[model samples]
Target: MELSPTERTRLRRLREQGRSDRAALFAVLGAGFVCHLGVVLDGAPMVVPTVYGFDDDFLYFHGSVASRSLAGGQTVCVTVTHVDGLVLARSVFEHGVNYRSAMVYGLPRALDGDDKLAGLRVLSEHAAPGQWDYARRPSRKELAATSIFALSLDEASVKIAEGPPGDGDGPDAALGLWAGVVPIESVRRPPEPDPALPGDITAPAHITALAT
Candidate 1:
């Protein structure tokens, strides 16, 4: 699906790097676990780091029922970014990061009853696949204590910067300094079992598959 751009999606710098594909937006979000949620609490701007999950058109998030960002019918901006590499330029001024980022704009509404539970399940499964089914489900009181919010993915923008360093042909190239791209990647480590678990209990296949 093609992404419909609003004013926010129009890139001023390196406009060519801006993406117009909805699939790219999903790719950036699915590759990362954390997002920065921006909101105005009271009279000041605040950014909170949290986990998020998304389906086809909606992103899900939750926190303690008392969180001000989730209170009322508040409009917010949510951003997810993943650093793919470091662009090492001969000149410090030309250095940059190879990355993918997305910004979503919407008013988040609270989900209750079955919707809340279902939203929570989406969030949990996205962050840690198979755990929702393997672990104990939340109780009535536990669900009551949590506050779930849903934001539409319809009004989102994506920007991706890839490839090697941009200064290879510039004046800085003559300096003889080593300048290229340093690729950055995320790898899963072997699962560390909890100390409190029974000796016979082992890591699930879903968990171990991350390393393979």
Candidate 2:
């Protein structure tokens, strides 16, 4: 299904880079576990970096129960972005970055009971695929101290910018200067075991697999 753009999600600038495909939105969100959440707290605007997870219908994030930023039932904007490369052009004005990003806007709902636990599971697995089962589950006391928020995925905007610089045919091309893409990639390194762990215990297969 294609993303249905709402008034706030409509792309007004560089519309060519805007994507309406739901798959594009999913790809951007799946590539990164962190997101910037924008909200108002105590009548002031705040943006906080937090871990996020999403399914086909909703996006979930959590914070301490005392965190004012995580208080639900208010409008919020969550954004996830991945930078692919630098687009070097002959002219500085034409230079840009290749990237994929998604912005989700909605009034989040505070989750509780079974819904809260399920949201936490989705958050855990999204960051570390199999660790939700590999590690111990949250205790009742821990759950009581946490607050989870769920935002609908029905309102979102996705944009992807890629390929070479855009000044190849422009007057800048005659400048006789170098112009190309400098690629950037996020690579996972070998897992570092806890210093206090037992010598006989090794990194789990699922964790070690990330390095490959």
Candidate 3:
């Protein structure tokens, strides 16, 4: 499951933090729902924050038909990142963030017909499990109004940072300043009912589970 990195995706800054396992990449990706997509349009670089989903091989996301990045057969970079903690070091220069991140590089392909619908299902399932089947399906008109793109996950890079501060053995240790990790976590709060929702329509069990 080791990831075979392409020349463009190779680790340079923090080689020690780079992960070669493909499963590590998938794990980082699967734990998050939103990703920033980077592409170029009309000689200008652009990055769009969008919701995403993935299978074993491809990452899927959607945007408006007018999106400049949605053009067929364009190379794009997608990054998914989760901040785990703040790394406090004895010295200000050594302070950093503990995180898990992945960057994927590939040419995006447009999806249509049955493939498009299936991709949309994957996206919905990723954002909220069981919602695809629970919510009303998208009509043909809705599908026509959206643009879905898929990119292979085969070319990607993964990095992870954890534990306490990294300067324990360095000169900063002699400085005797307090240094440790401030852990961060994503906590799901109770679901807020929509004001217009019918009283008879209750939240589903999957949603209840998510809100815990």
**Which structure among the candidates has the greatest lDDT?**
2
> Which pairs clash in the backbone of model 1?
none
lDDT of 2 by residue, 1-212 (tens): 99998899999999999999999999999998999888888788888888889999999987553266556357889899999999999988889999999999998888899999999999999988999999999899998888888889999999999999999998888989999999998988999989999999998989998784
Q: Whose lDDT is higher: candidate 1's or candidate 2's? A: 2
Q: Estimate each model's TM-score.
A: 0.95, 0.96, 0.95
Task: Point out where model 2 deviates above 4 Å.
Answer: 65-72
Clash pairs for candidate 3: none
What would the TM-score be for candidate 3 when compared with the true structure?
0.95
Decide which is better by TM-score, 1 or 3.
3
Clashing pairs in 2: none
Supply candidate 2's per-residue lDDT for 164.
99
lDDT of 3 by residue, 111-176 (tens): 889899999999999989999999999999998887888889989999998888889999879987
Single out the weakest 10-residue window by summed lDDT for candidate 1. Answer: 63-72
Q: Which segments of candidate 1 are over 4 A away from where they belong?
A: none
Give lDDT tens digits, candidate 1, residues 16-98.
88888888888998997788888887778888888888899899986553266557667789899999999988888888999
